[model samples]
Structures are given as C-alpha cells and as structure tokens.
Target: MAKNPESPNPSLSESPGPSSSSARSNGAPASAADPRSARSAAAPGGGQALSPGASSKHTLSARKGQFLISPRRVPGMQAMGLQPLALNVIEDTLRSSPDIEVIDTVGPKNIIGVLADGMSESPGVLVARMTDQKATVLHQQAQGRLIVERDHPLTLGDSMPLQPMMVSWSAPTSGQSLDISVTVLGRDDAPVADAAVYLFGSMIPATGTTDARGQVNLSLFGETPQTIRGLYVKPKTDYWSFYQTDPDIRTDEPNVVGLRPLADWPALANFPQNQVYGWGQKAMRLDQLPNQYRGQGVRIAIIDSGAATSHEDLKKIRFGFDVINKKTNPDGWSDDTVSHGSHCAGIICGSDNAFGVRGFAPDAEVHACKLFPGGQFSQLIDALEYCIEKQIDVVNLSLGGAAPSEALEQQILRAKRAGIACIVAAGNSSGEVQYPASSPNVLAVAAIGRLGEFPQDSYHAQTLTQMVDANGFFSPKFTCFGPQIAVCAPGVAITSSVPGNNFAAWDGTSMATPHVTGLAALTLAHHPDFQNAFKARGPERVDRLFQIIKASSHPINLGDPSRTGFGLPDVLIAVGLQAPMGMPSGLIQRAFSGAAQPQMMSAQPGQSMMGMQTMSAGFAGPYGGFLPPYLGNLQQGLPYGYGFGRPGW
Candidate 1:
C-alpha cells in the first residue's frame, strides 16, 4: 500500500526539545527596557518586583475616544462601580495583542471574549474585562491613570445585565386528537408533499404525514387545547394558514377555513413556549410531516467530522470510519476542545429519543466519514470513494471550503453516476456558494432563522409559511452565496444532542444540509425502485430517478434574488410521484432530450446492479429499515467535542 506522509502533532506523543533561539543566542547584553523585562522582574526574587513608589508609574494612551491602559491595572476600577460595555472584551484585546497567537473564543455568558492558543507569557493577564467609569474613577484614586476626559460625561447606562429569552412549556395534552386533513395547491391545485401543515393547539397532541393526497392528519392534545373551544392551524413560519370549516354553525359563520389571516384563533393565545431555536417544537416541522418515510429502506452517509456512536441518541451508528484521525472507533472523533463535526453529525443522524432533538430521518442509517474537523483535501476524497464503494444512496457533505476542488468534484460526479444522491451545504460564508454544492448533481441547501406564530413585529408576523423563496435561503448573515443554492430550510436556533448525551443550540450550513438529505432518504423510502436501478444491469433506471427528483421540485418566484433558489425540495418530486408545471423548462428538456441515448450518465459505465448485491453505495437495506433507531433519537446521540486523533494514533 502507498504510504501517506505522517504529520501528527509531536507534542502529544514526544518529549520536549530545546528552542532554536536558546541554541543560537551568543553572549548578548539583555536590555532593561525589553518587553520581556517584566517577566524576569516578576520571577521569584529574580529582580525588583515593582517598588512601592514606582508601582503607580503607568502610562495611558488615547486614540480617538478610546483609552488604552495596561490590563494589569484594570482591577482597581471595578470597585468604583464601573462596568464593561461590550459582551466580549477578551476578543478585542487579542485582536490588538502584540505577542499572542489566538485560537478560539468562548464567553461564559453573553459578554464578548477572545481566546488565544499561545499566550503563556502573561497567564491571568490574557483574560481581561473592562471596568466601568465608576470603577475607573476608583482606580484613578488608587494612583492608576484614569484615562477618561474631564469634559466627557461618563454614562452609567453602558453596563446592564444580559437577559436571554426564556420560554417554558405547559404539559402536553393527551386523549383528544384534532384530526386535520389538508389539501395544498400550487400553480393549478397541484398537491405538494412535505408541505409541513402544523396544528399548534395548547400543545401538539399527535402528528401524521400526508399520503399521495396533500392531506395531513394531526392528532391535537395539550392542557390548553381542552380549555380553548375554537382551534386554528397555520403554516409555521412563512405566509400560509389552514382551518377546518364547520357548515352546521349558523350563529356567526367565519367564511374562510384554511386561509391566511385566521381571525378565530388569536395568534398569540396558543403559541407554544420557546424551546431551543431549531430543536424545539416550533423549530421542527416533522411532527406536522406525514410519517411516509417511516419503514423506508434508505441509507444516508453523513460525511463530516465523525460520529459519536456511543451517544445515547446515536448508539445505533452501526458503522463509521475516521478519515481525519484514521481511527476505527467513534469515540476519538468527538473532542469538544476543537470541533463542530460532532454537532453537525448529531443533527444529521442523531437518535430520536426524548433526551435530544430528533433527526429528519431518524430511522436512516448514518455512515460517518470524518473529513471536516482536521480538514485535508485527501481525507474528503477518501470519504467520497468509500461511500461510492459502499454504494451509499445519499451522501450529505455538510462541510465546505472556499476554493473548489476538482478531485472532490470528480468524486461527486462519480457518486451521481452511481445513482448516489449528493447533498452539499451551500457554504456558510453567505456571499459565494461553494462546491460540490455548486455541482449540478448535488442539492444545495441554505439556512433560515426560526420564528413562532405569535407576532413580535406586525410586518414580520402573520402565518409565515416555509415558502419556495424567502430570506430563509441565502441567510445574508452566514456565508455561501451565489446561484447554486437549491433550497432553504430552518438552520438557526437548532438544538441537537452533543457529547455526553447532552443538548445545546447551534447554527451552520451543516445543520441545513441534513434536512435535504433526510428528505432525499424519504424519496428513496417511497420509491424503493430507485435503489433497484443501481442494482440493474444499466444506469438508465438511476438516470430516470435523478430526472424524477428534478421534476418534483416546486419552482418559486418570491421576487427576492438571494433567498430563493429552485424553491423548496419535495420527496414526491424526487421519487417521480409528483410533477409540477412550475419546474424549470430547461432542466426538463435536458433530462428527456437524451432519453433515447442508452445510459447517457454512468459511473464507470460497466458497473451494473446485477443481483441482490450488498448495500455498497451507502445503502443500508438488508437490515429492513433505512436509518438506525439511535440516529432518530435526539436525546442520546449528540457528540460533545469536535477534536480529531485519540491519545495515540
């Protein structure tokens, strides 16, 4: 086997070594004014530790309206009643630090802070908090320079405690079921699947998906539901609403049932308490989704950092490999110290339990291919190749980089030719969309901020439906922009399982990509025949399946260029179950234009699905269901940290 160069960190494995500076330094005179002088002076009895009279000798510099002082003298100001203004002072200092190598930042609270990787020269001093004006005055009295101008008024209102939004939920109601059957219409009354029809009563009683008909039956239950006489149902986030019409009531007939601007149910009266932004009840539309994906034979490959198979929510991660650490066990990949992989993985295929947020395809199998955390182009290629060899039907690449990789693009093309659906994140950096998401065969997804039905702002409120095109897609706040974005979904305030079976709210394109992957898995579940095409002697069937997915997408013209892509993705479209007139005519022409050609698209042409072959291309079938149960439970599977490598290689 060919050997790859080894470049693991030696500090974790080897002993100390002499510094080059020490070895090269000849007998040079040490200067008293050097910045390093403070360290030597502070050394235990090494020199004069600030003499009493000289202790107050400090200089203050002024730039614009801001005052700069030695961080060491900051404490005396605190007792004078002054407080820090910004949420993060540590971050500001590091950006201006002269001799420190900053790594990452973490704030204990909402206040700002900066983290540096190499700042041992000044240990406690590296972390600094600003003292308010009152504290500044107190410190000035203690001989430290008060940098404030005498003419400038000190604002006491600069400091205030941060109060994060808190939401609590009343116990859910049981027994009473609010059965709702919905009929969704598009250009000409065309039915749309996964349109997420939610019936939010006091609390959600029961949820079900729509069949071939765009009808969803919600079994409503909650303590508050019993108290409220009239119930109203509305599309969760976008501009849409639905209600049940009762013809028998002659007293005061409300003409519109299932229409926008619902008058009967006070919008604010029945709104649910806030949960974590995305993982909470309001964040997910699955409960409103039909259970059509249930029992489907679909396998989704989570190609990110790595999986925490041991997580209670994701214990069912049957098989996974570490491309970064090159390890076999799932444990080493989840180091909270430096990682976003585990969080991304937990969102994609987390276990569906009470403890954490449930995944879109909770039952689908997750083949974790660690390629993001300690990113390398080669690792990503290895993961793609592995998925192709294993025949993974749906490959979700949640992580992305700026410059496109031709090698990675080639692998995605291979996966597409092999009948493997590729789902990539639309890059997090908002302005430019990244590849393979930019690849034609891949489905690129964007993020959306979460909101409840209760109106916070009149213009912002009133039944916001998950529309085909909206600000939900090209979240200007995040990265990854350009025309490649295929669809948009909720990405903000998402709560998922983390390491140690705990849960926290997170955001990123990584979270958005999985929603599309799960939807693609649902497509496979409904059309088991798509997988069969890869098993046949030719690629014609697989090609047809791709055509089907293209055909099913709902074309949206929301008047916004940045937010809307190809509109929203529908499982029925990908499976050839539903065809809408709004689909791009050009795409349709290309798909059928070459229908006469025998397998115009093929992954290495000769490779055929001859018999009952094993689930090679990331297909997890012979096992009965598409995903493992642990991947479904939101409670147990979230990995804690996103670190690569174990104690040893």
Candidate 2:
C-alpha cells in the first residue's frame, strides 16, 4: 500500500493587513524593519509555532480618496450612505456621480475593488462608512494596492477514520456434501457470460456452467470431507482456458474464481512460415537435447503481462490469471498487452508444430500471471502466493525495479521455501542488476548475442564484438553488469510469437530470462530426483541447480566477469547431453559433490581444449543476419521499471 504525507501550510494570507514586505518587488527579501517583525514579537509561541490562520489587528495610515472594498457587499454599503461601485453598476452609479471611475477588481469569491484616484471621499470617511455598513475594510494602501484577508476554506485532512467490523459464519460439517460457488471474470474483472465448469475425482462427476454473472454452483460428495483434486473451467468464446488440479480450498468459505479474457489476435490475410532463428535454437542447443525431457508434467509460471493464449505456437495453457484485474481467468483477451510475456512464453513452451517455431520445453505446462498494467507491490506478492499454492516448479519474472522492496524479497524467499525456483532478468539498464534479481534466492540472467551472428537490422548488431571470446559470445553495449548475474543468454533480436498469430523479434534482458527458465524446467523434467532433493535440502537444491547450469556453461573470456556471470548456459551440457567445459574440472565436481548429486563428469585437460575449439567454430556460423525492427511504434521501458530495454537508437 502507498502512504500519503500530511499537507503543508496554505499560501494564502491570513493577517488583517499586508506586511511592508508584501508591497516589495517579487525578487526582494524580507528585512528586519518589515511589519512581520512586530507580528513575530506578538505571536503566542514567539512565531516558531504560529498557525497560518491566526488573526490579529493593526493600525495604518493611507492617502485620502484611496480605499479598498469587497464588491460582494456593495448593496450593504449603499444602505449605509456609502457609494460602493461595481463594473456593471458603474454605468448606473456614474449617472449619479460623473467623476467616479472603477479602477480594478481581484480575487475569486470576494472581489476586491480599488476606487478611483480622483474621488472626493477621504480614506477616514470611507473606512467609517465601511464599518457602519458592516463590511470589512481589511486594510488601506496609499497606491491603491488592495489585499484581501479572510479565513481559508476548510478541507478534509489527509487521514480518514477507519471503523472495524466483526462477523461470524457457520462452520462446515464434516462428511457432508459441500457446495462451492465459483465466479469467472474477464479482463478488468468483467463478468463472463457463459463458462462451463467441471468437477473430477468424485464418485459421480459434477458439472455446471456460469450464467450472466459469470458464476456456477457445484456440489462435491464423498464419505469424508472431500478435496477438489481437479477443477476444470472452459469459458465461452474469446476466453482463455483454465485448469486447477489442486486448489487451496476451505469447506467453510465460498470458492470464487476470477477469470480474464484472452484478447483476440489480429487477423492476417496470409500466414508467414514460422522460421526458428539460430539464436532461439542454437544458443540453448535445443536440437541436441532429447524429446522425452521436453519439460513434460512440469508447471512453469510466467509472472509478466499475461501470454497470448490464442497463439498457434502455444499448444495449451494449463492455467492463467490477470493480476492486473484481480481475476482468475483471462476474459477472452490476450495477456501480452506489451507483447513481452508472449515472447518469453514462446521461448519457454511454444508448441513444437511444423508451422511455427518450437520452444525448449514444448510440453511443459505454462501459466500466465498477468501483473504488468497494475504492477503494484501487493499484486506481485499475490502472484507469487498463487504460484506457491499451485506448487509450480519454476517462475520466470522478467520484470524488475531499481529500488529493492523488502516485502518482495520476503515473497521470493517464501517461494523458495515452498520449493519453487525463480528466474529473473539481470536488467538491460547497463548498470548494476535490479531486484528481485539482486536477491540471493533467484537466478539473475544477463544478455549475450553472437559475435558475427548479430541480427542484421538490429541497432545492436553494429556494436557486436568481432570474435567470440572465452565468455562464449558477448553483446556488451546494452546488458547490465553486476555480481548477481548468474548466466547470459541470446537476447538480441530474438524472434517469437506475438499476440496477432504472428511472429516478431524483440531485444532485452527480458528476452534472455525465459531461456534459463526453459532450461530449469527441462532439468526438473529429466531429473525427478531434483524435486525430492528440493524437499530434503531446501535452498541447497536451488544452489545445486544454479551450479550445474553455471558449470555446464561455455566460459567466455570477457574483460568484466560481472557482465557475463559464469558463462552462456548450454542446454545440451545442462541436461547431460554434452560434457561441461570452460571452468576447471575439479571446481565443477566440488560444487555438485553434495548429497543430491547430478549426473556430471570431470573433463580431461587435453580434450577440453579441443572441445572448446570445436564448440567455438560451431557457434560462429550463426553470427551474421540482422533482426528487422518490428516494434517501431511501441514505447520502450520494462513494464515495471527503467532497467529492462531501451528503444534502438
């Protein structure tokens, strides 16, 4: 929650007369001889604690025929035998007294009027007449400089009084049927008209559909208090699909589910051939890995602006929520309002279809947690809590802010305690890494583009280094540098699915984050024992996973270690298809020599040199083309903060 500070003192004048300093030029400063000195001397607390609205009386002399009067009390002045003229009434008054002329008027509510310079009335006589008319003649000035003085209007203070209320509900009975009511909402929490709901794992299958209010009622029957193991919801047209296997449900409370609609993908007259770029497949070495460990049965959540569920490359989205709208389901709307989350998702588990490009973990279950538009602190915490409750294996958070939030750090810690691994972008600000990436538990990834394999049309292509260094490949101009960076990945001009059933290219550390996320999913899929180790070793499991990926990376000899972390992670080596390289053989052994050992081997010194040469040459071939600038009209900046990516110059 955001806090509001108290309002400052009002600027309006509260004194009955203007101080001598008020008549000075705008650039002049107050002097010791000013009238404020007398007011300060007479104040109750010696001026230090004087209230802005405190009132006081003072006497002063002014030139004859110069008087100030509030136009609003003109009628009262006429009754007291004093002439108070207004602009409209001047024509009428002038007919009676031809010498009188209205000089000026000021102020909003109480219009202050300066009488003519040639009037025959004396200042003393005018003041006496004003007193008799029951009108306030605040002050008199020789040059006809009229200043209005009155109490300032009342305002509601900053803080509001809050009242607490207590209520009680009937406890649910054990061994009795329970009725659960679920509500489905669209983008911005709009109600879904007709959504089908199903309840599995019961003696008899129960099903219901939402009406106009986006609600449905279902009864769960069992001998004992039954837990809903599998709840499926299929929304009407334009809505994204939802499936929650095991929900955190209490028998006593109503189970309300909010849904967001998947925005329709822009239609196209002709479909382009889905060509998987070299950076997408070669950088992670997805071609060398086997299909069996393609992230099947693993649940990975993309905590970003939601994904394009309607994308042809995305085979199925298991579950999704619009954190921005506080809904459980997509309201028939695409989650990629910024087209960032969808690009990240394409690199994670895009369907391995013939027409579109395939992802590293094509079969992994993907969940979109939309938190971009309204990326509030509490909304982020709620998204993480949703992941924990769902028992998601991995969470990819490409968003980051410069200032660290302790509450956000605690949420990441809680996710870690719940056996969930968080992978974050190291940021594209070209400075120190941003949080929650800087936090100890999450894996912070940096960006790296191939030397000669640069995207031709990309602005970063001209800034690419000529040769691949010991750090594998480097793209230094835009990537952030810091000790928190865990690894680097191909991030420049990477092509992926957009919201309109189309493929486009993007550049950012945000684009690099999902590469590591996909690899983590593959690791969990291939090594089921890692999950068991996560339960037993706690955070050490995360450390071991990080070390394995780091150790398996192809080391690059960059000038600054902070720019590239350990090195570029090779999915082939990470999943045990290829041997680990670059780092010392014994160091890799010592890092993973724990109780939860992964399948790894020490590389021979002589063979390691030959393998590095072979790998370097192989990576050099894909280093030449340019990525066309597709997002020419989109605004630059990560959804949450300033550290993501900037528009190409």
Candidate 3:
C-alpha cells in the first residue's frame, strides 16, 4: 500500500518487511544489518516493540510462535493462481530452523500431526509464537512466512494486560462450607435472572448465577459471615452492575440486593431498553434503513472474550475460534465468561427473536474469536491470518495494548491487502489513541453519549461531562482522542448481551466500535459500489470503504475533531438510499487512499498514556484491592463515578 502525505497524522515511513522465510532456509543468522535468526525464548508478559529514540538494548528473547513459511512471495490483492505450497517446504523450513521451537504444527491434510508441535486449528494454518528482539529478528528474516507476532497480551480491559491474563479463584480452606442463598432484583422489584453473583470471602471466593426466581445458593468456607471480602452482582442486561465493599450479612435470613434499571427514567417510559433498539442503533439510523439491507452476505469476526451462544439473539453466531483454548476446547469459543465479546456480537449480529435485542446487521454471518481473560499479540496476528484465509470481510477489535507492535502493523497491512476491514476502539484512556486503532490501515472509533438515552441516576449518568452539544451528544471524557479518530459512535451506557442469556448496559470506546463494524457489513452487502468484485475486490477496497463512510457521515457538533473524526456514519446515506453516487473507476481509491490517519509510531516511548483497561460496570467509582496499573487509572481502567469523578488510582 502507498503512503499518503496529506493524512491527518504524519506517520513514520515504514521499512520494507523482513527477508523471505525461504531465504533463511539454511538456518544461519542473517548479518546484524539484516538480523535474521529464527529463535528466542518467549517473555511471559511481553511489552511493546520499541519506537525510535528508545533504548535499543533489550533482552533478545523469543517464545513459541507460529511460523508461516511459504515458498513464494505474497501474491497481490487479487491472488490469481495462488496454490498451497508443498508439505516438504514446511518440513524443510522447520528442519532448518532448530532454534525456532515447534510447539504446534498443522499440515495440509488437517492431519493429526504431533501438536507437541501445536499449530492453527485447521490446515493452511501454522504458528510459532515469539516476542522481544529475538522474535523481531526472526520475523524480519522470515518475511515470506506469513507473520510471527509477540502473542502480546490483550484483555477486555478491551485492552492488553500488563500481567498474564490469568486470574484464579482461591480454593476453600478445610473448614466446613456454609450455604447462603442470595436473590437479585431490579429497581422495578422484578426478579433478575441469569445475573452473575460473586462473593469474595476471606478464605474462599464463591460465584453463581441467579435462577428464574432471581435466587442463587452459594456455599462459603466458614459458617460465620466474617470470611467475606465483598459482593458483586452483575445483571445480564437492562440494569447496572452492583458491587458492595462490605455488607452486614445475616446468614439466618434470605439475602437480597437490587440494581438500578437502565430504563428507570420516568420521562422515557416509552423507551423499553430490552424490547427497543439501543440508542446506538437509532443514532446510526438503522431503523430508518430498508429491511432488505440487513447484513445477510457479509462475514464479520469479533476478537474479544468468548460469547454466550445460548443467548437467543446470538444463536445466529455459530462460527468461532477459542484462541485462548484453541487445542483443548477448539469448539468452545462461544463459552463467554467475561461477556465482552457477547456484547459486541449482539451489537453486530444479534437477532430480534422473541423479545430479544436486534443488532445493526442481524442477518450477517457472525464469527466469534475469544481472546479475553488473557490474549496475546501473537494470538491476535494468528487470528488475523485466519480472517484473511477465512474471507472475513470486516472485523471488530474492541481491545487495546499499551505499546505498538511493528509486526502487528505489517499484519494489518497484509489484512488490508487481503481486503479485510478492521474496526478498532480508540481506547478509554482519555488521551491519545491506542495502537491498531491508531494504525492508519484500520478505522478507529471514539465514544459519544447522548443525553436522555439512559437512566438519569444510574451509573450511566456518570459519563456525562459538561461537553454536551446542541444535539445532546457529548464526547465522553474517557475516550482516547487524537487526529487518528475516524468516527464516533454510541458508547455510553450501551446495552448489549452478556454471557448466560443476559444483557448489560456499559460504557467505553469498546462499546462504540461494533456499531461501525456492523454498518460496514451492511455497506458491503448492499452498497452498489461494493456489490461487485471489480469495485470491491482489491488492496485498497477498505480504504475506499472508509472514504465512503467518512465522506457520507454527519459529524456531531462536539467541536473537537480529535474526539469525533467524521462523527457518526449514516447507514441510509451510505447504502444508496439518501445520497447515491456514481461509481467511477478508482474514483474513491484515488482521492481517499491517503485520507486515513495512523500517526502512533511517532510518539515518544512511554508517552502513550494508555494502561491495562478491563470493562466491569464502568460507572464512576473507586475499585481494586488487587494491583496498580492493572486496575489503575480511571480514564484507563475504572472510570466509574467516584467522588469528584476521579479514577480508583
């Protein structure tokens, strides 16, 4: 792809990709200038690849990473005559690179190869994860190989975690376990079923889901209530998550807790959040669009925590990859524990079956890629490779990392070349945009909130800043802002599906990105210019798509271009209804190729204000008895409404 000088952010010129994998078939190290040796130990929790001006001296470590060794250079956007390389080629490449540990290997036949050499789930997938300078050297030398990313950490913090994405519940001590029954209710005094209830006790942590009667029986380690640390009740949807630091427990009687409903505002009784489309859907004017424009022909992928396939609305989402547990439970990708991916899936393809919430593109083919709780960059890159091979037209990435990965940048370029569009979150740091989203090759979206769309006194109200515009839409104070923002969408108090046939109304740019991804699917399925192969199939197709979406968007009067790029994209205006335009040869490509903004590489190392961000009922409040940076920074981590609207840090 060619670089555009007139782009919003001036990006550093990218160096040519590393040498082809075939070139290093001899296993000898390429010189320091070329730096090619395919082996290094994997760092447990990897950091970002260094930018210019940072100390070049780093532990040259590498870990288990997928090795995409192909015999030929990558083909063009239209890979005409492309054929799978011979198996000997793969065998020879592995034989030559002894330093590159072979954790997994998937061959052409989907053969039961020794996963002691673990590889991609299916054929056409071979992975070897690694990071650090050793990983960088290997990637650069093995250019012809598809990609070798760090398997860097990714979380629902829709972010990359500083620690390995592993959190464990303590097993109970030898003392007798006591059973306690708890009931969850909504503000309307209605029983809240399918809600996740957690009890953080001194010696034991117990968790359970509320049943139809809104009751959950929990067994604690001690007979007395003294072992309790805290209690957290998270509803499936239509209510706020409730957390109590300490509570007076009367084990003798039934315990009950109530949550605030998302639709509690007396003035907006007509708006039933569960039955009606979310404000985000209406803001994009999905209701105004024709019934025929549903995302029926598009393939959309969401990389986040797993999703709850049992959810009625998300039942259409059958295709998935459990990147977290690929080999063990390859078919268990839909096992959403965190509920983040389920939310994004609902926003994109959730159906309108029997009192369920409808998505922007309810008919689109949905593929869920679970990587939350803990995900790595290497994992993300591998997922992208799957997307390219899977013919995924659009992908939603509602996660971020503290630092940038040059390997990821190259992979994004490849995905773009392969004609896949990536929609990413701008981050919730209240600072410059995060990587991937900051990459000009992708579309980065910020979060915007409209007044009266949520309960006035609920946690959702905490996101209201004084920045309201004439239309009542305000740029959230937590949204990462910069010249890289491509657009804004409804992120505040967003109501979407969680795990276990439930729903939750939350905030963060993570909640905003899916709107654009869903819209992109609809555009590809219906927009005239994107309807045919000639106009839509090419390296620059997404760039052209971005041009159309941005050019046709109506920006809210937020008065900050950094906060709201082209504002919200209008679906009707894009799909040839409101303002249809003639499709000329390379018309949009020529003018809009350079319009994207990817200016992240130029920032000084550590200037990135982003930290580990995980979304848990992000209503302003002080949280975290765990660790710093992991749960630090309100704008970065917990932005709940605490005293004076400050972070827990």
Cα lDDT computed for each candidate against the true fold: 0.43, 0.54, 0.63
Off by over 4 Å in 2: 1-278, 327-333, 454-457, 462-472, 528-537, 586-649
Q: Largest TM-score belongs to which candidate? A: 3
Task: Write model 3 residue lDDT over 1-649, tens digit each, in one string.
Answer: 2222233121221332233343356776444343223222112244443333233245453323333332322222114343434445655565465344445443222132212112222223344432234445653454323333333466553321111112235564587777788999886678999888877666546789999999999987654676565677767676776666555666787799888765554432433434667788888898788777788878999988877989887888879888768879867888888788898888888786644457888888888888878776657866776677677889999998765554455456557766788999999877888777766567889999999876553445545678889889998767888877777889987777776766677788888999889888888888888866525554557766777776556757766667887667788877768762333334333224444322222222222212222211111111111112222322223222111111111
Summed over model 1, clashes come to: 80
Ranking by lDDT: 3, 2, 1
- Encode model 1's per-residue lDDT on 362-457: one tens digit a residue: 677777776544554445655665665566777777765443433343345445555577777776654555545655446666665444432332
Model 1 misplacement above 4 A: 1-285, 288-292, 327-339, 453-476, 528-547, 555-557, 571-649
Q: Lowest summed-lDDT stretch of 10 residues in model 1?
A: 640-649
Candidate 2 residue-wise lDDT, 438-509, digit = tens? 665677788877654432322345335543575347655567667567677877656677776866545678
Error of 3 at 504 (Å): 1.3
**Candidate 2 at 602: error in angstroms?**
25
lDDT of 3 at 74: 27
Give all candidate RMSDs, comma-separated: 23.9, 30.6, 16.7
